[model samples]
Structure formats: C-alpha cells, structure tokens
Target: MPATRTLATREAADLIELTRSLAVNELSPKAAEAEADETFPREVFRMLGRAGLLGLPYPEEYGGGGQPYEVYLQVLEEVAAVWSSVAVGISVHALSCFGLAAYGTAEQKEKWLPGMLGGELLGAYCLSEPHAGSDPAAMRTRAVRDGDHYVLNGAKAWTTHGGYADFYTVMARTSDDRSHGISCFLVQADTPGLAADPPERKMGLTGSATATMHLDDVRVPVGHRLGEEGQGLRVALAGLDSGRLGIAAVATGLAQGAFDLALRYAQEREAFGKPIIEHQGLAFVLADMGAAIESARATTLSAARLKDQGLPFTREASIAKLVATDNAMRVTTDAVQVLGGYGYTRDFPVERYMREAKVMQIFEGTNQIQRMVISRALSRPAKGTITVLSEN
Candidate 1:
C-alpha cells in the first residue's frame, strides 16, 4: 500500500488515491465472498462508473477522464490488487469501447459515445469463438446484410461480462475474403436474438462471468457498424495492443498482492522460536518475490509510457504481458509455498491468488501467443538500421 513509485502529475496521484480508497473499502472486503459464491458484482461496476473510473483512458469530451494510458493502467493495478475480477472487467469494458472510439463515424460517436463512456452502459468484447480462440482470423461467426441491418449468427466464446453487459462490441465475418471479411458492431444487450450461454465453471476469477454468447439471427443496424467492412481485424488487433497492457498491469497488481500477504505472514508467523522471515531460507524466497513484482511493474509501466507517447508498442505490450503474468504465476505460487500448509488452505487467500494468477497467463492471448508476437516483431527490420560497407 505504500507508494511504489512517484506520479507524474498531481491529478494522477489523486486518481490513484481515489482508486486505492475504493479498492480497500469496497472491493477487497467483498471479493472473497463474491468469488466464493461465484456472484457477479454488477452494482460495484456501476459505482465505479459513477466515480469516473470506467472511462479513464478515453477522451474527456466524451465524458471520460482523458488520462494517459500510464495513469489509467496504474489505477487499474491498484484496483486489481484487491479484486482482479473487477479490474479485468474494467479492462474489457475499455477494450469494447476501443473500436467505436478509434474507428466509428462522427455521427456514431455523437450518438453513443457519451453514454458508453459515462458508465451507464457496461460493455463486453466478443471476438473469440469456440472454434477459433487463438486464431480469430479463422472465425466463422457470420453477419449477413439485411435490408437495413446485419443479421449475425454464430457464437462467441469466453465472453467476459457475458450476460450482464449492457452492450457487446462484436466482430463477425461479412465476406469470404479471409483477410478482409470481418466487421465490428455495437449490439445492445437486449437484442432479441442474442443470449448468453451458461457461465463456464472456472478455476479462478469466479466472480467474473465467462460465457459463450449465442447470436442467433441477431440484427444490428448498419449504423452500428464501427468501421469499413474489412477493418474489424485491424481494429481488434489495435485494441488488443492496449488490452495486453491492461492485463499486464492487473497481473503486476496480483503479484504485488500475493507478495504483500506473504511478507506480512512471514513477519508475524514464527518458526524455530523466531519469525520465519529471520531464516535465510525463507527470507530469500520473499526477496525473490519482491524482486519479481517490481520487475513486472516496471515492464508494464514502460509499455504504458510508450503507448502514452503514441509510439508503436505492440512488441513492448506483449513483453509486458508475458513478463508480468508469468511473474504473477510464480509469485502467487511462491506465496502459497511461503505460507507452507496454511497457504494451500482456503482459510488463507494465497490459494485463491494462485488460482487467479493462472488465468492471467492464459487469457488476453496465451503466453505462448505472446512469445509468437514478440518473435514475429523481432523478425521485422528496424525503422532505422545503419549499415556500414564491409569487405570480406
């Protein structure tokens, strides 16, 4: 809870404090019970919306906070430290809005942007399908052109905020051209033919609903289309670049939470007539955990800074997500180990932390996919590579 790093602006500092207050007072207390019950805390999201936390990274003219990605991500980390489900929900909502914000027509923005950013309407991203989780380009969800609408048919898998979202930002195939066939649509949650399947029984993030959304003859107006017919893939990929950073921050926060718990327990729990932290064996573990958490935080923030500067951050984003999430998995697991048998029990939250941390490496693209992204980026030539003439 102590200051981990200094803020660039007073406003950023204020936002962090506000988020911390909410996380400590509201989120942390209810996380255990809600996760235990597998209940989605819908009202808590509304409270966050009302507090102007939901739209931190969007333009201020559209009722958002208009903060830099760097500031917004840190706020996300603060919330994530207490309740990861809520933080992940926040990240998905931001991603759901990205297409419209970045690609929608001015008229569309005028009509829907304010309400979306104002927090009255929670949003979900629907790009992944059952047959195509990693290779979204191979998706088969179809959207046929109707008189004045596009009738969507197919299912989206692993949809967060599935049944509860007020709106869904969906991507569906519109043509046979594999590279340029998809399009984005903003569909209202109450659309007659759209329904969420039963939630997936998950190992972690139980409080966050994940379900397959069925689009059975769902009709969205042509006006709801976000960009050109073939631009959906581009929009989705660009959004993921930022979304990866969000997950990175959340992963870092999760690691920090686990580390804090382990440290506190070490200080209080004694072994061999002294605090276990006094023993070099256990002390080294705690030290390594601390080091990992800080490293993850720095990697994530560095990516955010690049994003804030409008630099190309695709590689950095993947790197951040990979490092932070992998570190989170390790740190949370170590926290459980540090607690010895007590950590494995439900009586302690380290078990839950370990469970939650596992999914961070899997979602927002798997760590395997992240490595692919990083390596592919590496394969590309640099923008400026100086060459010196050499005689062999």
Candidate 2:
C-alpha cells in the first residue's frame, strides 16, 4: 500500500469533486476574459467562498472544510490548472489566516477566524516592502508601540489582493534589532491611513490584484499583535514556508492543465498525413510534459503530507516549490510550441498559461530562495560537533 494515499478521505474526495465542477463550469470559462482584461475576479472568489472551497484544510469549527493539507493542496492544484490567479489568491488568503490560527489568542480566533475562513472576507499578506523582498531584516515598515495600539508606517510592495482584501497581516519593525525588531499585526483594510497604490501591470496573475500598500501612521490595536512584540520574523517566516507549499501546488496544476491542453490539441490537430499525435518529435515532447507534471504533483503532495504529519517540511517544501514552478514554466512554454502559430496569438489559451507560469517561479520567495532554504535544511546538524582530543 502507499505510505499515505493522496486522496484517502471521503470528505476530501467530495471536496475535490466539488472544486472540479466549479473549475470546469465557472473558472475555465472566464479564465481567458479575466486574463485579458486584467480584472480581479472578486465575484468568482466569493463564489468559491460560498462553495467552502476557500476553507479547505482548515478546521470545520471555523466554517472550513477540515480537510488535510495534502488534499487541500491537490484541490488548489485543480483550481490552478484552469486559472492560476484564483488558485494563488486562495493560497495568499490562507497565509494571511495563519497568524491567527497558529499564534492568536482564543478570543482573537473566536472573533476573526470565521469570517476569514468562510471567505466572506478576503486576506492579504504584507511582508515584502520596497526594500525588502526576500530579506525581512531589511524591512522599513515600522510599528511603534503606543498606549493600546501600534502606529504602523511604511509601504508593502507586491501585495496580492491589496485593495480588495478585507484584512492584511502586516510585518513591521518594532525596534532596531534587525529581523528581531519585526512585529506582526492583523490590520483590517477598513483601518484609517491604509491605501493601495493602484494595481500593477504584471507579466501574469493579473486576475489577482497586486499593488503597494501604504500605511500612514495606521493604528493597529495591541490586541491585534499576532505573537510576542518582537516575534514577527518568526511568524513571517512560517507563513512563507507554508506559502511556498501553496505555490508548489499551483505550479503543479498549471503544468498539468497545460499538458492536458497540449495532449488534446495534438490528438485532434492533423498535419501532413495524419494527426500530430502520430509524429515522433511532438509525441516525445508531450511525453516529457506528462512526466514533468506527474513528478511535480507527486513532489508537491509529499511536502503537504510532511506538513500534515507535523514533521519538518522546510526542505521538502522548498524542493517542491522550486521543482514544480520550474516545471510549470517549461511545460507551459512547450504547450505553446505544441500549438505552433496559434499558441503565439491571443486566439489560443496557451499564451495565457505561458505568461502565468513566469510568476510562479518568481513569487513565494523565488526559486533562488528555495534553493537557499533546501541548502540550509540539508547542511544543518542535529547537534553541535565536538572534537575529541587525540593522543598527542
């Protein structure tokens, strides 16, 4: 038997089935339109929220699916296979919810958890700044302690759902102790002095809003602090680890979706004497794409399994994120090749998939960061090395 089945639980299977129906019936149809218009599908997100797809992997007590991370990520992969923007947005929202789930007080959970999990309120994570993309220690966003609140000041860059989210989990400097000086806050979007700096024109994932968030002396109550005063870096890093897993899932889905399109097109599109599927050259490319997609899926699922088992998944997650995203870029580009001239034009959906794949490699701490994480995970020792004095 498999160490752990990918789709074991009936609840998980049902949730996957539901998401598939939604993806095929709703997401796939509007994907092209959304990408072309560069419009955020706020309503589509609400539809997913209503379907309870947004809450997969969360506890049922909070109006969530209560599914395992493995299953949830697979479902995420399915969503991404059709439209990556939606899949990534869902993952980012889940990352925003992490602070409360892992570190918030019970009262805080009772108050904020339901809306976030229910998808009634979207979420945005604010850790990267103009100066700090992968380096949190260089963050300039400051949160000064006041009587009962912290005054937040600075801009958060490349924030997904920037203006659209109901909440933002912000990380800002509290002291001059580098990374340790950072603090995390659950700042509502309705808070005064918080403004989104217009959506950016990006290479892909245009359906998901991306912008800079300006915090002008915004006051976040002391009660809204995620963990301890100076524990923000820990929280931010944890969120990033989990976010990398999410990206891995999305990347796998994109690859699979692109492969499926290429396969069908190859089988149907006739050339020369017969269908292109009969051609050895094109067949080899399709086979490689298939292998890459399946491998990415397996790797991503393994990382999720490690996370679910409460094991150290840092290395596994980084590996998954790195491999899956790179595969997505390759698979999508090859898919465009499969379509020949049609792929190059907006007339075909392969062009959109190709554009979306580029961001997957760049976001969620970048593939370079993933390599660093994997290296550290591999290089670290369980305990400090000690030298025994040899007989001299």
Candidate 3:
C-alpha cells in the first residue's frame, strides 16, 4: 500500500516521486544481500550524494538540497521503507553536520560545510560513550588544549557509520564542570591516534556499521572546535532533538513497510476457502496495524512541522520518537505473526523488519528516557506570558 501524503508544493511532490523511484530501483534490490553479508553500501551513499538526497535539510548555498525538515523527513521515510540502514546513515550524517552548521564560525562553514553537505564526505556524530549513554554529563573523554592543538583521549561507543565515515563530530570534556566542561570538535577520520574498532556484530541493520572510536592522545587543531570552549553538551543536545525526529520518521517507515508485507500476505494466504484477510480476527489485526502506522506518521510529521516553524519542539520530538518507535516494534512483530511460520525465517522481509525495529526504541534516546524528558518538560513552568480573564 502506497502512503498517501499531503505534500505542500509541486516541488515537494516531485521530490517524493523521485525519492520513491530511487528507493525502488536502487535501494530495495540490494538491501537484503548487503545486510545478510554485513557489507556497508558506501557506493549507494555516494550515489545519493550525487543525486542531492544526502543534504536535503541543509541550505542550498552550502551545496545542500535546502528542503524544509518536513520534506527531508518524508524523503527519509521513503528511503527507510526500502532500506532502513541507508536512511539511518543519512540521519547520522545530518546529525554530524548540525554542530558546525548551527554553531561554527562563518569561516568553518565556508571551509567544510560544502563538502560535508554535498555528500562528497560522509560524517559521523561521536557523543555516546560506554559509561555515558544516557547521561552525557558523565562522559569521560577528555580534550586538553595545548597551544594550537587539543589532545583528545577516550572512546566513543555505538557510533553509526563509525569506521566508514570521512569525518567525526566529537564531544569531549575540557574542564571539571559537569555540564559546562564539554567541548565539540570536527575531527578528520584520519587524524593521528584516532582509530575505529571493528564494527559490532548486530541483530539487524548490519549494513549500517556501528563501531567504537578510540582517541588516544589524538591531536585536533584548535580551529576545528565547534561553538565555545564549554558548549559541547548544549550543541549535542540541540542536535539530538532533530536527530530524534529523524529516527521517528525511519521508525514510521519501517512500520509501513512491515504492514504492507503483512497485508499482502493476508490477501493471498488462506487457511480456509477465503483469504485470511477476510476473516474477522485477522482483519482486525490488519486494521490495528494500519491505524498504528497512520498515527505514527502523523506524530512524526507534526513534530517536523514544529521544528520547521522554529518553535520549541523538544517535548514533541521526544513524544514522536517514543510513539513511532514503540509503534514500529508492535507493528513489525505482528507482521511476523501474520506471516505464520514463514515470518520466523529469512524467506520474507518481515522477519528482518522485526529485527531492525527492535533498535529504533533504544537509539536516539530510549523510549524510557524519552518519558523522562517528556515528564520533565511537563513539570516545568510555562515560559511565555500568561493571560488573565476578567469576570463577564
């Protein structure tokens, strides 16, 4: 089933069609094999870059597509529907660019933004450490300044596109102040003493490389630092709100893909004289899956709109991440059940979808952590002025 989207302009509609075509012709055919072999599809990314899909949300002046977040996310969703690893890779690449684009000096933007945004160079965000997965304030990575360079030492864990990326946006402690000590840097992948450990063996999305980055007295030029000396955590957190939205869109697409597979199976597979889809019990299950996918898509797009409008959407982004990922988990699992014994094997893609969906809830902030963020936002006092009513 094709997703019915309400696009805003003719350009947006055309972009979607172009994305769908690429997804169908290029990504879908290679996804299963690349994933099964645990091979990274670097060429696909290069192709996407050449086609201008890699920089959809960045400014055109810097060689980006200049589309709004809403449109970029929809394109991401289309890609995810065909190949999730590529969609996630694109998101991480965008997250890696966020600090420099949003906080770096004009000189830095002029120097590096074009290549990074143009997709000529893939990027990775290095924020999570083994001990600081949820609490970035506790990260132990240190970067001590010495004249013209900063000597960095520590490890970053669970970095997507880790070994394959051309550049890294790294965060490290620069002082003793828990919140204010951290600093961000745009480090080249080939910097001395900076090495990536072998990629992790995973449950799914094996096509997307995840590895630990080790920085052992790695010297980064002071000119590569992003933002102020102590603003790393702020920059990381700001990028995450947008990153969460990207994950939400990918999760929604995963759900949609699984639902489409299950629906088709229900229409063809029969336990009795009629198709299983005609049976009330199985029909209702399909209905619920459809509803969940639609709800997740709506929530994801609504959050994107809030972000595009320059509103405070941190709370909404968390909500969308939580809802969409949880929905994906449920939908993908039920898709397997709908396929019966066939779903448990590799013959169909639903099984792979199920495995891939499991991680969406855990990354970009776990669903549990998302709840904490939402509750904290709700507990805070409103920021804007309040209006008082007079007696009528």
Candidate 4:
C-alpha cells in the first residue's frame, strides 16, 4: 500500500473515514506479514469487496461503485499508503476489466462483468511476454481458431495475481499481421492447458503475487474474444492509456506516504538540542518534497480529467507517469535519509518504499519510454510551424 495522509474534504469526510477505518483495521496490520511471507492476501480483497471499494470508478449498472476517476484514485492512494501490494492488486483488477469494459459486447458484459466487478473474482492482465516487454507489436502469443474455439499457446510474463486470479485478460496474435493480427481474450484460470506458475520473488511489492502464465493449447469459445478479431491493439492501447494514469496515481500516493513518514520522523527526532525538523537543511528538503507532491498531484489529476473528458491524453498521461514516478523515487530515497539508520532496515517502511519506487520508474513503459512518448508528441510541430508566406 502507498502511504497517504488525511486530505481536506468535508464532503468525502464520511466516506473517507469509512475507507480508512477498514484499511487500518484489516489491511495495514497484515501488510508487512504478507510481504514477508511473499503471500498474496486473498481475504484482504474480499474485505475490500464487502466495503464496495473494488467496484469504484465504474458504472453501477454492472455492480460498480459509479465513482469518478479522481475519487477512485484518492481511494487507491489511501489504500496504498497502508499497503501497496493490495493497492496494486486493485489496480491490476481494474486493468483487467479494461478490455472487457471498453470492447466487450452486451452479451459478454452481462455474462462476465458482474462477477468480475464483484471484487471476489480477482483478475489479471497478461500483455507482457518474455520476448515483448514494452513492445506489444513483438508479442508472440498465438491464438488460432479451431472450429468455434480459439486455441491459444504462449506465455505471459510478469503477470500480477497470475496463479491466484479468477480470470485473465490475454492478448494473443490471431493473424500474421503485426498490429492488426492480435486479439484479446477473457480466459478463466482453471481452464485446461492454462497454468499459472508460483510467484516470482521480487525486491518489493512482495505481497502481490507476480508470475508467468503458460497457455498450452488453451481453448476458448469465440464469444470470449473481446471486440473485433483485428481490434486487439486498439483495445490494449486504450486500456494502457487509462492504466498509465492509474500508475501515476499510485506513484503520487507512494511519494506522499514517504514524505509523511519523513515529516513525522523529523518532528520527533532531535539533534543539537532541537528537533531535526527545525534544521533549515532538512526543512528545505521537506519543502521540496511537498512541492513535488503538489505538482505530481496536479499533473496526475489533469491527465485523469482529460481522459474522463474523452480528450487525446496520451502525451498528458505520459507526462503524469513520468513526473509522478520520478518524484516517488526521489521522495522515498530522501525519506530514508530522514529516518537515518532506522530507515535503512526493515524497521522502517522507507526502504520498502524505495524498492517499490524503482519498479514504478521501470514499469508502465519505463520513465525513459515516457520521455520518448512526450518527445514524439512534441515532434508534431504544429503541422508546419515555419510556414513560408509567399505574398499573393
């Protein structure tokens, strides 16, 4: 979970209180234990489900919470502040729902969306492959139509909730075409020839099970394929466009949490017969951290609002992801400094936050890739900036 603090909101005060109450009572206490054991907390999700948090940011017609993206992100922020793994679980679940929600037909939605949104049926998104990490065009997972069923055979790497999820949203090559050949499928976990390996040990976010999924001749009905046979790339891209904002939100939450921890620590720890927070040097650092958080929050919210307004936000989303994640890495590292030796050990969460921050910079198309995206968007040059004015 990402660390967050109480925000100013009299309107959501009641709801926020309720959200925090459950998080403190149930999620926070078990978070460290779960990370230590490298175990996924299945029951924790169920608890969130009962509280109607899992369905947030979706329409209420299909068992959703009908909340806005802004509200939903803050909720996620609160959850992450206490426990990042579970917060990431919620993020992945929401990601898995993307293709189905954006591309699924009425029949498909009616048949599958309810249980998925129920919060009990965990979901995972399978797009990254051993060969294809950032490049989806290079994906090798193949899905061939056998009679009325699509037989899939390939492997997906770095799948969160891999072995534990109820279903997976898989992207597979349906034809020889690079971009248009791919198709998305909604596959149940226990389906024959579909296997999720044991979780891979990682440096951080240990409580969220990350593993590889093997699909050896896994067959599914044609109805399960999301959208048109050639529309998988669009579905994947669209989902990712939204998904990146979710990550930005996560990054913001983590940065805020780290700053909060450092701030609290600074106020308590003293040197030279004064609290460390009284030192101009440390206070300036805290000021910088707070400034970054505020900026990150602003950028992230701007991107999300643009998305919710149906504007072209690829560049904006990339900007938010890049800024927020980079901020997290910096904030978390400085948080460790405030805690001194204690921060370096497992006794403090600052170290864990640091580890978690590294991955945020790497994933969602790495901060490097985000820069590439922004550059590409900028290279457009206003459709011909240096217009020659030959007088007529």
The Cα RMSD in angstroms, rounded to one decimal, for candidate 2 relative to the true structure is: 5.7
Which candidate has the top score in lDDT? 3
The sequence of per-residue lDDT tens digits that candidate 1 reaches over residues 1-392 is: 34386898999898899999999999989999999999999999999999999999999998899999989999989988889999999999999999999999999988898999998899999999988998989999999999999999999999999999999999999998887999999999999999999999999999999999999999999999999998889999999999999999999888888888899999999988999999999999999999998899899888898788777899999999999999999999999999999999999889999999999999999999999999999898888433343567
251-285 per-residue lDDT for model 4 (tens digits): 88888888888998999999999999999999999
Candidate 1, superposed: residue stretches over 4 Å from native = 1-3, 383-392
By summed lDDT, which 10 consecutive residues of candidate 3 come out lowest? 383-392
Query: lDDT, candidate 1, residue 93?
Result: 95
Which pairs in model 3 have colliding backbones?
none
- Ordered from best to worst lDDT, the candidate numbers read 3, 1, 2, 4
Q: Between 2 and 4, whose lDDT is larger?
A: 2
User: Model 2, stretches more than 4 Å misplaced?
Assistant: 1-6, 382-392
- Model 4 weakest 10-residue run by lDDT: 382-391
Quote the positional error of residue 173 for candidate 4 in Å: 0.0
**lDDT agreement with native, every candidate:** 0.93, 0.89, 0.94, 0.85
Cα deviation of 155 in candidate 4 (Å)? 0.4
RMSD per model, one decimal: 4.2, 5.7, 3.3, 5.2
Clashes of 3: 0
